[model samples]
Target: MKNTLIVLSLLGSALFADAAKPNIILMMADDLGYGDTGFNGNTIIQTPHLDQMAKDGIKLTHFYAGNSVCSPTRGTFLTGRHHHRYGIWTANVGHLPKQEITLASMLKEQGYTTGHFGKWHLGTLDKVISSKGAKRKPAENFAPPWQRDYDRSFVTESAVNTWNPGAGNRAKNNPFYENGKALDPDDPTLAGGAARVVVDRAVPFMEQAVKDGKPFLSVVWFHAPHEDIEAGPDYLKMYEEHGEGAHYYGCITELDEQVGRIRAKVEELGISDNTLIFFCSDNGPEGKTPAKRRQGVTSGLRGRKRDLYDGGVRVPALACWPGKLAAGTESDVPLSTLDYFPTLGNLTGYEMPDARPIDGQNIWPILAGEMDQREKAIPFIRGNEVSLVDGEFKLLLPKGELYDLSKDWSEENNVAAAHPERVERMSREIAELLESFKTSHAGADYNDPEFKPVGKWKNVGSKKK
Candidate 1:
C-alpha cells in the first residue's frame, strides 16, 4: 500500500503538470486477441516492441472494448455513450448518427486538429453506387469521417486486405477516401503491410499538427489480422513453423512493428512527455477455433467474437504517456473504451455542450491509482445478449448466469444461487440502463435548449434485417 500511495501521488502531480491540451493518439487493432502479444504471455508471437511498451508505461490487465464487434465499439469510443443509444446494434448494421457528438467534434472545439486513419466501419465512404459495377451499392447508411468532424481522414467504409489493400476487388468496392476524394487504386501510397500503410498516413498528420503548433487527436485503427489476413514474405517466414498460424501470427507481428513506429515517432517529434498513446483491440478475436487462418487465442477465456463473455470483450490494453504515467505498472480496474471521451475531456477541461446521458465515467482517477474498483458498471448488449460487469460480479441476462470475474476469469462457475440478493440488485440496475438507452435512441438527447441544429435520430437497425 505504501508503494501504491507513492505512485498515486506522483501520477497526480504529473497529470496536472502536463494537462494543458496534450496531444492524444488512440490506436486500435482490428480483431486482436488477449493472448496474441508477448506482453500478455504468448511466447510464439514476437511482439518485442509492444512488450517494451508495456514496460515503459501502464499495462491494463482487465481492459475491455466497448462492444464485441467493430462498428458499435467505434461508436462507443468516439461518443462515450452506449452504441444502442445511437442505433448501432452490430457490425455493418448502422451508421454514426449526426445527432451524436463525437470525440473529434469535442476536441476540435478545444482547438485541436483531428485525423482518422484505417478501417472506418462506422459508415460508408462512398455514398453513390459506382457505375463501374462495384459490389457496394448506394450506401443507405452513408456517414463518412470527413462528415463526422475529422479534419483530415484516410479511411475505408469497411475492411480491406491486410496487405495490398488497394489492388483488390474489395478496394474497388470500398476504397480509401482522403477528405472525401477516393484515391486511385494504383496510388503508390497504398502499398505495403496494412498496419504500416495506416501508420504511414498517421505519422504525417501528427508531424503537421506539431508543425502548426496545435494539439492533435490521431485515431489509427489498423485492419491487420482481421480478414483476408495476409502478410509479406518476411513476416510469413518469421512464423513459418506454425503452419497455417503463420499468416495470422505474421500479420499481428507486422501490426506490432507499426505500433512501435508510432511510439518512436512521438519521441522523435519531442512530444513524448505530453502525448498520450493508447493501444487496444476493437474486440476479441474472430472465429471459434484457433485453426486454419483465424488463430486468435483469448488466453483461455470463454467465448469468442460475438459472445457476451470475457473472451469477446476483454482485450489487451496498453497506455504510454511518458513523464506522466508510471512505468511498468499494471491495473486490473475493469476499464472500457467508453472511458476515452470522459477521461480525455476531464484532462483537457472540455465539457459536453448539452446535457445527455454519457455512459462512460472519467477514469483518470482509476489510471492515476487513486481508485481501483469502477464506480459505474460497464454494460454491453448484442442482439438479445445483455450483460453488465458491475464491480466484481457480471450479470448475464436471458441466460441468467452470474460470474464473479474476480475469482473465475474463465467463467467456469456460476454463483447466482449463492448470491441471490446481489444478482437481483444488479439485474434491476441493467433494466434501468436499458430503459434509459431506449429513451436516448428516440431523440430525447438532442434538440438542446440552445437549439443546436442536430439531426433527428435515424433507426438504422430497423433496416438491418
Candidate 2:
C-alpha cells in the first residue's frame, strides 16, 4: 500500500507538470524605422524599455519581416507561412481568407486561451462590420469570419487615426474600439494612440490568464509613428526640449514607456520567468518622401515601405523568456516571421496541423543553442518583383541586381555584371520556385506595370529610383 501510494503521487506530479506551458506575448510596432532605437545606434530617440529588453533577452540582428508592408507581414506572422500563399500580397483594406490556418486557432486546440489586441487587419466578422449601420456590401476581398480564429479579438477595420495632433482620436465616439468601449487615444497617463488602447486591454487579459491558471497567447500590434505623427503635450514637450528632433523622438519615447508598463505587469504577476515575450516591427519606415515631410531613416538602407529593398523588409526583432533564452545573447542568423508557427509548436509540444504546405522551418534548435545553421533561402515577391537570398548573396531579379549583403547592406552597388553566373543560377532557381506558386486570383495582375520588372529575371546595373 505504501509503494502504490508513492506511485500515485508521482503520477499526479507528472500530470501537473505537463499542464503548465509558457505564456506568449507578441508585440509588433507599426512603421517603426530600423534606426529609431538606441540599441540600433539611434542618437536621437530614447527607447529605454526596448533597450533593456534587448539587454535582458536574445536580440535578432538579421531579422526580416515576411513583407515590406503591414498587413502581409502580420499575415505571415500569424500563419507561419508566406503571405502570398494565401493571396495577402499587400494591405488591401480587407480581411484574410477563411481557409488559412492561423496561430491562434492552432493554439486553441492545445487548450490555450488566445486573444489579439490592437490592429487586426486580418479580417472581421459580419457582426463587427465596418459600415456603421448600413447594409453589408458584397464582401469584396474581405476575409470570412472563419479566418479570424481568435477566442477574443479587437482590431481596427481601417487605418488608425494618428494624424490629429494634440487630440489623437480617443474620444467616446472614436471609431477604434471593441465591444463599444472607447479606447483612450490621447491619455497623457498612458502611451500614445493605438498603443495606449492595446496596453490597457492587454493588462487585464494577462491578469485574467493568471487567475485562470491557463497559458495565454496575446498579440498586441501598435499603430504608432505610422503617419500624421501625433504626440501629446507632455511627450511633445519632452522632445521639444531636445530641439528639432522632438516630434519623431517623442513618439518613440511614448511607445517605450507603454512597453515598460506591460513588462512591469508581467513581473507583478510573478510570471516573468514563465512568460515569453516577442517584440518586433511589421516592416520598415514609411512617410520618407518630401511630400510627407517624414523625419525617419532606414539605417542607410535603400528604398522605403513600398519597395522590396532591405529598408522595406528588414526590421528589428527581440525575444525574451527569462530562464529559457540566454540573457544578452544576440543571434545574427537570418530569421523570418514565418518561422514562428513551427517554433511555437515545438516549444509547447503541440502538434501543428500538416494539411497545407508551410514554407517556414522550425528554429527551436537555434533558440535552444543546439544548432547554428539556417539551411534555406528566403523568397520574397511583390507584384512581379521577386528576390531570393541564399546566404550572403541576395539576387534581385528581372532587374538582376546582385548585392553581396555581407559587404553592402545598403544595396547601393549592383554586382550582377561582375557575377553573371551567380545571377543566372539564382534566376533559374526563382523561376522553378515561381512555377509552384498557385496564382488563382487576378490580384497579381492589378499592379503598376512599371514595377513589374523590378522582381523579374534580367541583367541591369547602376540604376536609381
Candidate 3:
C-alpha cells in the first residue's frame, strides 16, 4: 500500500497546516499617543502607513493599555481577564458582560470569521438608544457587537466625528450600528475620515471572510485621535505647519491611511503570509495638558489620559505577519492589551479554559524572539489608583511610589526610600493581587448568576474582605 500512502500523505499535511489559521487583524487606536505614530517616534505625524507598519513588523516597545482608560483597555483586550475582573471599571463605566469570554467568543469557537470595525466602546450599540434624560444609561449598557460574538458588525456607540462622521451631537447620539442595524442618519457610507469610515466597514469584512473560506477576526477599532477631533480638507492640508496641531496632526494622518488600507488588504488577499496584523492604543494621550485639540504626545512618558503613569499605560505597539514577524524588529518586552487573549490562545491551538482568572500570559514566547522577561505581573486599577509592573519594578499604589523601570524611564526618581525590601515585596504583591481582583469582582468568574457586580467597587490596593 506504499506504506499506507506515506501515512495518508503525512496526515494530509497535518490537516493542511491546521487549516491555515492566522488571519487576525486586531488594530486599535483611539486617543492614540506614545508620540502619535511615525512608528512611535512621530516626526511630525505623517505616519507613512504607520511607518511602514513599523518597518514591516514587530515593534511593540514596552506596550500596554490593558486599562489606562477606554472601557478598561477594551475589557482587557477581549477577556484575557483583568477589566476589574468583570465590571469594566472605567470609561462610560461597566458593560461587556454577557458572562464574559470574548476575543469574539473565542475566535467564534476557533473557526473564526468574526468582524467588529470601529469604536465599540464595549456595549450599548442601541437596544433602542434612549438613556432618556441622559447620564449615559443606554439600558444599562446593552452589549452589542452583534450580541458579543460578532460574525460581522460595524459598531460605534461612542465618539464620532473625526470629520463628518454622520453629522453632529456625537453623531446624533452615538450612531452607526450595522449588523443589528442603525446606520442611516443620512448614511451615505457615513462620509469621509473617521478612519475612512472605519476602513469602509472593514474592507467588506475582510472581503467576506476571504469569500467564505473562513479564518478572519478583523477588529479594527479606530476612532482616530478620539473626541470630536476633525481633519479632512486633505487631512487639514497635511498639517500645514501644525497650527493648533493641525487637527491633532490631521487626525493621525487620517489614521495612517487606514493602516495602509489594512496592509493593502493583506497584500490583496494572497493573505500576506497568513495575515496577523496587530497594533495598539486604547489609552495614553487624551490630554491633561497639551490642548488645541489635545496634541497627544508621550514619548517622554510620565502621565496623560487618567494617569496610571508611563504616560497612562503606555501604547503604540505593532505586529504584522508577513512570513511570521521579523522585518525591522524591536521588542522591549512588557507587552499587554492583555496579551490578546492568550496570544490568540497560543496561536490557535486554542484550549483557553481553566474557567477564568486568565490575566493574559501566553505571549507567544514574547512574540517568538523566544521570551526574555515578563512572566506575569502587570496589574493596575483606577479610581483609588494602584499599580504594579514587577520585573524592573514599578509599584505606585495609593502613592507609595517606587519606580526603577530600568533606572527611571521618566517615572522620575522615587526609590521608595531606597527600596524598603522592594516596597515590602511589591506591597504584599499588590495586596495579594487586590484579593484576587476581589474574587473576580464577586461574580467569581461567572457561571452567570446573570453576571452580577455592576460597577463602583474600587477597593484598590485590597483588604476589607
Candidate 4:
C-alpha cells in the first residue's frame, strides 16, 4: 500500500507535463501468453521493469488482441478497423492494402514522425532472396513499410530465430530490412537476440524524433518467444535451471530488458510524462500440446492460440502515460488493440471520419479512470467461427455455448442452457456480425481498384463449413 502511494504521487506530479500532442510507443510481442510477464503474475520470469511500468500506469485486466494470430491482428492495429475488413484473414494470406489509412499515416499527417521496428508480418518487405538458381515469390508479395508511410523502419517480414537471426536453416531466412535496403550482413545487431536488434533501431528513431522536436509514433513489434524461438547464451544463463524450455523464458527477459531500455530513454529525455507507452502480446501462448516446446504459459487459461476461447484472444496489456494516467490502477473494462487507433486519434485530435466503419471506441476516458464498461461489444472472428461478447457474457457461435466471463474466466461453464433469451440474442448478433465479415471478405471494403484479396487463401483453421 505504501508503494502504491509513492507511485501515485509520482504520477500526480506529472499530470501537467508538456504533452498537448503526446508521443506514442506501441510495443507488441509475438506468441506471448496472458500470464507470461512479471506484471501478469508470472513469477518464474524476471520482468522487473515491465512490472514497474504497469505500476506506474494502468494494467488492463481484460485486454484482447485484434485477432488470435499475427497478420490480422497487426492489420487491425494499423487501421482502426478490423482486419477482415481489409482481406487479411490470416497470416501470410493478404497484404495490408495501400488504400487503408493506417495509424502511422494518420499520425504522419498530424505532424508526427512514424517508424516501425521489428517484425512486420502485415506484408513482405522485399522482392526476393536468391540462394538457389531460382527465386522465391515474395516478389508477388512486396508491400514494404516505406510504402505504408512509415518515415523510417527496421523490420523482418515474418518470424526469425530470436537468437542469431541472420544465420539459420531455410525457415529462419527472413531478411532484416532498414527502410527499403537490406540490413547489410555487416550490421552488428543482426546477430543478437531479436529484441536487442529491435530496440537498437527503435531508440535511434525516437532519438531522432526528439532531436527534431517532433512527437513520434514508434511501433516496436518484437519476435521473441515465437516460432524458431531461441535465446542467446547471456539470456539463457538467466534461466539456466529451466532446462530445454529455458529458451522461451530467457528470451522474454531479454525482451523485457529492451522494454526497460525504452522506458529509461523516455525518462532520460524528460518525456516520460508526455509519452504514452503501450505493451501487449498479439495473442495467447503458442502450442496447446507440451511437445511444441514453445514453453509458453497462459496461467491457467482454457485454450492456447488459434481458438475462439478467451485464452486465444486475451493478452497481457499495460499502458503508461505518466502525465494523464493514475499509477498502480487497474481497469477490468474490456479493451482491444483495435482501440489504440481511436484512443490515440481522440487524444491527438484526429477525428474519425463518419463514412468509415471503425470497431474501436475512443477509450481515453477509460484510460483516464473516468469510465468503466466498454461502450460496444467485442467480436472475435476466425474464419467462420465467431464469438460475440457483450461484457462478461460471451456467446460462442455455431453451437451457442455461452459463458459469463466475470464468473468463469476459464470458460469451464456453458450457461447457454440457463439463458435461452441471451443465447438467442447474442446468436442473432453473431450472425449479423458474420455477415459483415462476409461482406468485407467479398472486397466490398476496398474502394481502390488496385486493392486485391488473395482469392485462394484458406485460414487453415477456419471452422466455416
Candidate 5:
C-alpha cells in the first residue's frame, strides 16, 4: 500500500505540470533600428531595462519581422503566414479578413484572455474622425481589434506624437481608443509618457487574468520614436548631444522604463516563471525624411525601413521565460515573426484549420534548444520586392543579388556571377512561392466564394506577374 501511494503521488505531479500554459506577452518597438539598443552593441542610447531583458533572455541574433514595413509584418504575427496571403500587402492597405483565424482566436479556444495594447494599423478605428495625412479606412473597410477576436483592446489607428499623442496634428485627434470608443481627450491618466499609458492599460488586464487564475496573451506595441518624436524634459536631458534628435533617443529610453515595469509586474504577481515574453521591432527605421531627423541606427547594416536587406527586416529579438529558456543564451538561427502562431498553437494543443496553408512551422523545438535550424526556409514579398534566405546564402531578386550572409553580413558583395547554380536554385524557389501566394490572395484559402478586396488596389507590385 505504501509503494502504491507513492506511485500515485508522482503521477499526479507530472499531470499537473503538463497542464500549466505559459502567459505570452509580445512587445514591439515602432521603427526601432537593429543597433538601437545596448544588447545589439549600441553605444549611444542608454536602455537599461531593455539591456537587462536581453541579458536575462534568449537572444535571437538573426530574427526578422514579416516585412520591411509595419502593417504587413503585423499581419504575419497574428496568422503565422505571409501578409500577401490575406491581402494586407502594404501599410494601411486593408483589414485582417473575418474569414482568417488569428492567434487570439486560437488562444480564446483554449481559455486564454487576450488583450491588444498600442498601435492597431490592421484597419480603421472609426467611420469618421481620421488623422490628417494618415491612411483612413472606409466605413466598409472598418476592422478594429474587437472585431479581430481580441477580448480587451486599447489601441490607435496609426502613429501619433510620442510625447503629445492627443494634440498638434493636421486634425484634432484622440487616437487612443479603449474597447470600441475613443478615450476622453483630456484623460490625465495618459497625459505624460505615451509608452507609460500603453503599459498602464496592459498591466491591469494581466493582473485581472492572474486574479481569475487564467492564462493570457498581452500585445504591447509602443508608438515611441515613430514620428513627431518628442521626449519629456527629464528624458531629454539624458541625451543633449543629439540636439534636435534628443527626442528620438530620449523617447526610446522612456519606452525601456515601461518594459521594466511590465517585468516587475509579472514578478509581483508571481507569474514570471510561467510566463513567456518576446520583444522586437515592427520593422527597421522609417526611411523617409522622418529617418533623417529621427537619428536611428542600423548597426552599420545596409538599407533602411522599406528595403528587404538585412538592415530593414532584421530587428532585435529576445525571448524570456524563467525556468524554461536558459538565461544569457543566444542563437544566430534565422527566425521570422511568422513562426509565432504555429509555435503557440503547438504549446496549447490548438490544431490549425485545414482549409488553408500555413507558411510558418512549429518552432517550439527550436526555442527549447532541441534544434539549431528551421525545417523550412522563410520567404518574403512586398510589392515587386522579394527575397529568399536559406541559412547563409540569401537571394534578393529583381536585381538577382546573391550574398553569403555568413561571410558578408552587410551584403556588399554581389556573388551571383560566382555561383550561378545557387542563384538558379533560389530563383526557382521564389517563383514557386509567388504562385502559391497569388492563389491564396485571390480568396482560394477561404470557403467564401464571394470575397472582395477591401482597399486601394487589387495587387500592388513593382513588377507585374
Candidate 6:
C-alpha cells in the first residue's frame, strides 16, 4: 500500500507540472531604434527600466522585425508567416483577410484571453462596423478600421498623431465596452498620444485575467517616437539636461517609464515567473535632421527606417521568462518577430492551423540553449526587392549585393563579385521562392500598383538601374 501511494503521488505531480503553461505579453515600440536602450550600449539616454528588463531576460543581439517597415512587421508577428504572402507589404493599406488564421484566434481556442492595445496599422477597416454600415467599395478612400485578427482589440484608425498629441479619430460609440459603458474618446487617460493609455488598458486587462485564473496573451503596441516628435514635461526634463534634441530623447524616456510600470505590475501580481515578456520595436529610426537624429539612436548600423539595411530591420529585442530563460545572458542567433506565433503556440500547446504554410519555426529550442543556431536560413521581401541569408552569408538581390555578416556588420563591403557561385545559388533559390509565392497571391493582387523601389539602392544597384 505504501509503494502504491508513493507511485500515485508521483503521477499526480507529473500531470500537474505538464498542465502548467506560461502567460505571454508582447510589447512593441514604434520607430524605436537599435541603440535606444542602454543594454544595446546606449549611454546618451536613460532607460533604467528597459535596461533592467534586459538584465533579467535574454537579450537577442541579432533579432529582426521581419520587415523594415511597420504594417508588414506587425502582420508577420500575428501570422508567423511572411507578410507578402497576404499582400500586406506596407503601412495603412487594407485588412488581413478574415479567412487567414491569426495567433490571437488560435490562442482563443486554447482557452486564453487575448487582447491587443495600441497601434493596429495592419488594416484600417473594422469588418464588424463595415458590415452594418452602407456597402462601401474597396479603394484608397474606403479602407477598413481594424484587421480581423484579435478577439478584443483597442486600435487606432491610423498611426496616432504624436505631434499634436491628442486622441483624435478613434471609432465613435467605442464599439467595444469598458466598465459596462463605451470608452470616452476624449478621456485623456485613454488617449492614444503617448504610452500611458495603452499601458493603462493593458494592466487592468492583465489584472482581470489573474482574478479569473485564466492564461492571457496581451499585446501592447505603442505609437511613440515615430513621427512629429513630442514630449511630456517629466520626460522632457531628462533630455533637457543633454541640451539638444531634448524632445525626441524625452519621448523615449517616457516609453521607458511605461515599460518599468508593466514590469513592476507583473512582479506585484506574482506572475513574473510564469509570464513571458517579449519587447521589441517594429522597425528602425526614421531618418531626420541631425538634431532629430541625435535624439533617435541606432547601433551604428547603416540606413534608417523603410530601408532593408541592418539598421532598419534589426532593432532591439529582449525576452524575459524568469526561471525559463537564464537572466543576464544574451543570444546572438538571428530571430525574427515572425517566430512569435509558433513559439507561443508551442509553449501553450495551441496547435496552429496546419492548412497554410508557416514561415516561422519554433525557436524555443534555441532559446532554451538546446540548439546553438537555426538550421535553415530566413528570407525577407519587400516589393520586388528580396534578401536571403544562409548562416552568416547574406545575398540581397534586385541589388545583388552579397556580404558575409560575420565579417561585415555594417554591410559596407560587398563580396558578390568575389563569390559568383554563392550569388548564383542564393539568387536561384530566391527566384524559386518568389515564383511559388506569386502563385499564392495570384487571384488577390488587389490590383495595387507594383511596389516601386524607394532609396539609393534603386538607382545604384537595382536591376532597373
> How do the predictions measure up, each by TM-score?
0.92, 0.82, 0.35, 0.91, 0.92, 0.84
Clashing pairs in 1: none
Clashing pairs in 4: none
Better of 1 and 4 by TM-score: 1
Error of 4 at 163 (Å): 0.9
lDDT of 4 by residue, 1-465 (tens): 334433443453344333457999999999999988988898888889889999999999899898888888898888868787767777776678777778998889989999999988876776664222123346665678999999999988788878877666523446788887886554666878889888998999999999999999999999987878788898778888888778888888889999999999999988887899999999878887544348877777778889778888899999998857899999998899888887777677675444566777677767877556777678877766777778889887666689999999799999999999998887777667656755665566666566566444333212455
Cα lDDT listed for each candidate: 0.85, 0.68, 0.80, 0.80, 0.82, 0.71
lDDT of 2 by residue, 232-333 (tens): 677778777655456566766777888889999999999998888988888888765423325667788887787778888888889998887899998877
**Residue pairs of candidate 5 with colliding backbone atoms:** 384-462
Summing lDDT over every window of 10 consecutive residues in candidate 6, give the lowest-scoring window. Answer: 452-461
Which candidate, 1 or 6, would have the higher lDDT against the true structure?
A: 1
Candidate 4 has an lDDT of: 0.80
User: What is the Cα root-mean-square deviation between model 4 and the actual structure?
Assistant: 5.5
- Could you give candidate 1's per-residue lDDT for residues 307-407 as a string of tens digits? 78999999999988887788999999999999998888877777678889999877777776678877788999877778899888898887789999999
Candidate 1 lDDT trough over 10 residues, lowest sum: 454-463
* lDDT by residue (tens digit), candidate 3, 63-159: 8898788988898898878888777788886688887778888879978889988888876766556322155677777788888888788877777
RMSD of 6: 7.7
The candidate maximizing lDDT is 1
Ranking of models by lDDT: 1, 5, 3, 4, 6, 2
> What ranges in model 4 sit over 4 Å off?
1-19, 129-137, 170-173, 290-292, 442-446, 454-465
Candidates 2 and 5, the one with greater lDDT: 5
